[model samples]
Target: MDKGKNKWAVLVGCNYPNTKYTLHGCINDVQAMRDLLVKKFGFDPKNINLLTDKPGSFILPTGANIMKALNRIVDQAQSGDVLYFHYSGHGTLIDKPFLPFSKEEAIVPIDFNLITNVDFRHLVNKLPKGVTFTVLSDSCHSGGLIDKEKEQIGPSNNHLHGDSSISCSKPKAIPYESVLTHLSSLSNINTTDIGTHLLEVFGADASLRFRLPHVELEFYKALKQDEGILLSGCQADETSADVISEKGEAFGAFSNAVQQVFKENSGPLTNAEVVSIARKILANQQFEQHPCLYCSDENAAATFLPQSATAASSST
Candidate 1:
């Protein structure tokens, strides 16, 4: 961190407890990241915002709340500031008829409302020059979460398939059909249009990206911006795993791999370096998911977190 600048972070984890979508590792991921941001990266505890679905958590990771927090951070950020957002949860794809890809990626909040890639693009466009927002999304289908960004480490045909024999592991993905079924059940709307269901339930708070006309969505996708850096857990077509160890310890496989890389390296790791090391870690563990880095070539070579002298020395 530059002495003249400040660092802020928003760490979110959604373990949809008592529900069919429940997972055991997301909350743990958030806690570990919070510790890393404070002790290893020199972030003030007061500057980090935490949102989770764990019982008694004052702030829940609802879609509205998540967007609010992100907007607040972008609104307040100044030139040379360092910012980060880490998300550990289920990720899903939504149909986007106008786009060539045919779908858009989004992260699922605790209430099933989604925050889409277009939303992220809008956020990035608002960022001041010299300010960077680094995102680490440990979720399935997370590769392109920061829409239109350049790919540094992308999917390859040689990627290995996951080992099915690995016990106590679950993919952190909720299928589009399943999402529609759940939302229909909740809203009593029997249509297949996701936007309609979301509109019925969340109304004005629903993601505008979903409700926008196809022409507008196309226009938004065509606009380019470069202040966002994304380190996604896996390729858009792959699924990230949530694993439970023999001793009952649960964690996101990708998140654990990232932490392992940080522990094994002393000095600051570049955005590309961290994703590269994490990819190897996941491969050695027999996980099929391939971590990806998306940003400008310049950002790919930038430090994971701009660190103060004390923080850099302590890590060494």
Candidate 2:
């Protein structure tokens, strides 16, 4: 652990207000996580960058804005610093026709500009070797959020096809009504069978070939060697629950479970331990989705928030 290293966090939550996909808990989830980071993990409040869909918020979680924020995080990060990204929103899977039977998982921003697993892979690959990137995604189809990372704690991969790390059935989808609402809000977008058009135009192998022209083919070919820890809300085929808790507060089931688990445990927990306990908590609450952990085998046993948890536990 780097004693003088800084801690930076980018917390994003999209509720998609006024649309058919309006969620009640995304913003709240990020807020709760922000608080936890500051209070428990020793993250400096000023270093935390928050992007949310609440009206008049400083920044909105649009795809471009998100990319910019991520770039800033990576650019300013020093080796040994801890970078954390938390996103609570809708997730989807888009087919990559270039690769036969390949579907990329994506996080939906407020403006509907999709941020795919490829983008995340690019970001993670750019991180300094010693820096740790932790991503917590509380969204549907959130498994494999970091792209090509090994699943340290998840379902058996024997059922997964091809290079997919998570064992999942057919990917679930957002409601068509939500898709219509989003498309209709865009200027000059013809809403007539726009979904079909998206599949035909964006789904083709041609566009993907040009998507990242700056990067060499080898960049996409190689799996990332940097440390990236992903805690996903559910398997690729499952829908995450966004329900109100018994106390009348709304939150994503997996996010809430993680919070509760973290609050209860004071010892230094590994990634595998945290995921295991969080999964049990969600299951006890009757959530259908199962939380997953993805990282290298060594990191699976590393202390969660390595510096913070270790220091705290040693002090006790």
Candidate 3:
């Protein structure tokens, strides 16, 4: 099938407001991306869908908001449509018995909620084959949030534990202390609340003290790889930064770099090209950011993954 000259780009960037424990720059990034997609990527404004924190939390995605829109937008997906999904905010991973959650398993909001990886999988499953599923996550513990963290102690569990990495085989368990430590640092995140939940899932093990861990993203399943991509600002081994410049203005290092790359580069870039340039811009901040690129285009649609993620490989 031939591609649509007017591809769709869905961007979600949030900027937390009225509080310190919120993400304040993602909202700007989402809007900026929306503009770039329209002006540079040939995306029609109508095809672009943007979501943010509800009731003016101003910057965050609640589980309800994500679920509500999942079906509506997915149903509209057509062959050759490019579904661009970008999330900039908080993220986490679960360790132990972590099967990806069904839609009901997680709640998402400024109030602190759960969102399992299956929610995302379900969204992908609903799309017509050959549509581009691009996602960018800026949250610290985001990897596990996309995958289901299972409780290790099962069948009359005493403590709670779950892991969120999904692969062809059953997912391996991630450690509890690792995921929780990331949660504790969030401005409004309560260590007790995160710990309590982990305890419920894994069962309290006095022998097992909690340790902090970074989130990790599993590669896409081959069956689901009709043509999708994921670009992370950095690897799980590194810390994703909140940019506080000498001017005292704060933003996500990842998001800021994205804006810079587009602002500096001319014309539409390929997926590899975009990732390459974004990598450079991010490195300048000393954040050790790395732009990731994943493509599921059997027809080689990855070559057409918006010239954003595949920047270096293409010529503008």
Candidate 4:
């Protein structure tokens, strides 16, 4: 860790309780991550901000609130500082006819407000040099959450065969039509345009990528950056699993695999190494979802959470 530099993090988990989209393990995932950061990684408790949808949570994991927390962390970042954002929730894909891929990745906030990959690209472009912003998203279709980042590990045509024995698993994703229907009910706007529904509900707080013209969206996506690192739960076309263990504990499969990797390794591991190990763990456990790492080659080889000087020193 750089001496006197700070480490900041924003952890968000949305269970969407009491609704049709309820998830059982997202909150538990973030809580466990928070404990790991504080106990194992030497992150200060105060510097780690948490947003969840559980009853009486100080801050709800709404779209605007999530962005505010992220922006706050980035605004306070300085050279050599390490920043992290972890989100365990539902992810969705939006049709973007303007792009060659014909779709974009997004995370679903509690209020049906979706934050798109283009929005992440804009946020990442503002980072100060020497400040690393690493994001871990344990949600479905999260592979490309940070747009235009170099693909160190990505989708493949060959699917790894797994046991498929896990019986109580659910996909942590909401379809685009479902999101539009939910938003339409709230905004009283009946249309297929999700952008219109989001604009009506969130106004200026809505993601600009949704409302921007196709040309502007392309421009934002074209902006380049080296500061953003993403560890996704699954490939762009795959779904991450939320499993109910035999012990009745609920957690995201990818999140569980990550925790297992950390437990199995004592010394610091590189970003790519962590993802690679987690992918193998999931595959061995009969999961089809493949975790991915998105970053420059240099960052791929960089030590995971290297800014935690105390943890690094103590582990050695």
Better of 2 and 4 by TM-score: 4
In TM-score terms, candidate 4 sits at 0.93
Candidates 2 and 4: which is better by lDDT? 4
Write down the RMSD of candidate 4 (Cα, Å): 2.2
lDDT per residue, candidate 1, 1-316, as tens digits?
2332889899999989998888889989989988987878889899999999989988899999999999999999999888899999999999975555588799999899988998888788888888999999999988878889999899865565444334688999999999989999989987888898998999888887867776676665626547789999998778999989777889999998898898898778889999999988888778888899999888898888878777778767
What local distance difference test score does each model get?
0.87, 0.72, 0.50, 0.85
- lDDT per residue for candidate 2 within 1-316, as digits (tens), equals 3332888889998888896677878899899988877767777799899999998998789877887788788888888888889998888766554565666677788766667776777778888878888899888867866778898778633322222122222222465346545555553466454344444444432122235543453475435455788999887667787766446677777777788887798656788898988877766655566788998887788766654654465434
Models sorted by lDDT, best on top: 1, 4, 2, 3
For model 4 the local lDDT of residue 212 reads: 82
Best by lDDT: 1
lDDT of predicted model 2: 0.72
- Between candidates 1 and 3, the one scoring higher on TM-score is 1
User: RMSD in angstroms, candidate 1?
Assistant: 2.3
CA lDDT, candidate 2, residue 258: 82
Candidate 3 ranges beyond 4 A from true positions: 18-20, 54-60, 98-108, 142-224, 297-316
Query: Residue-wise lDDT of candidate 4 within 1-316, one digit each (tens)?
Result: 3332778889999999999998999999999999878866778999999999989988799899999999998888889888989999999988774555577789999987898887788778778888888899999978788887888887766455565445588899999889878889989977777788889999988997877887777677635548789999999778998888777889999998989898888777889999999988898778888899999888898877763667656654
lDDT of 3 by residue, 155-270 (tens): 22122223312121111112334435534554344644454553444332210112222132233223533444555555454445555455655566676777777778765556
In lDDT terms, how accurate is model 3? 0.50
Give per-model TM-scores: 0.94, 0.82, 0.64, 0.93
Off by over 4 Å in 4: 1-4, 97-101, 157-167, 222-225, 313-316
Task: Please identify model 1 stretches exceeding 4 Å from their true place.
Answer: 1-4, 99-101, 159-167, 222-225
RMSD per prediction, one decimal? 2.3, 6.8, 12.6, 2.2
Q: What is the lDDT of candidate 4?
A: 0.85
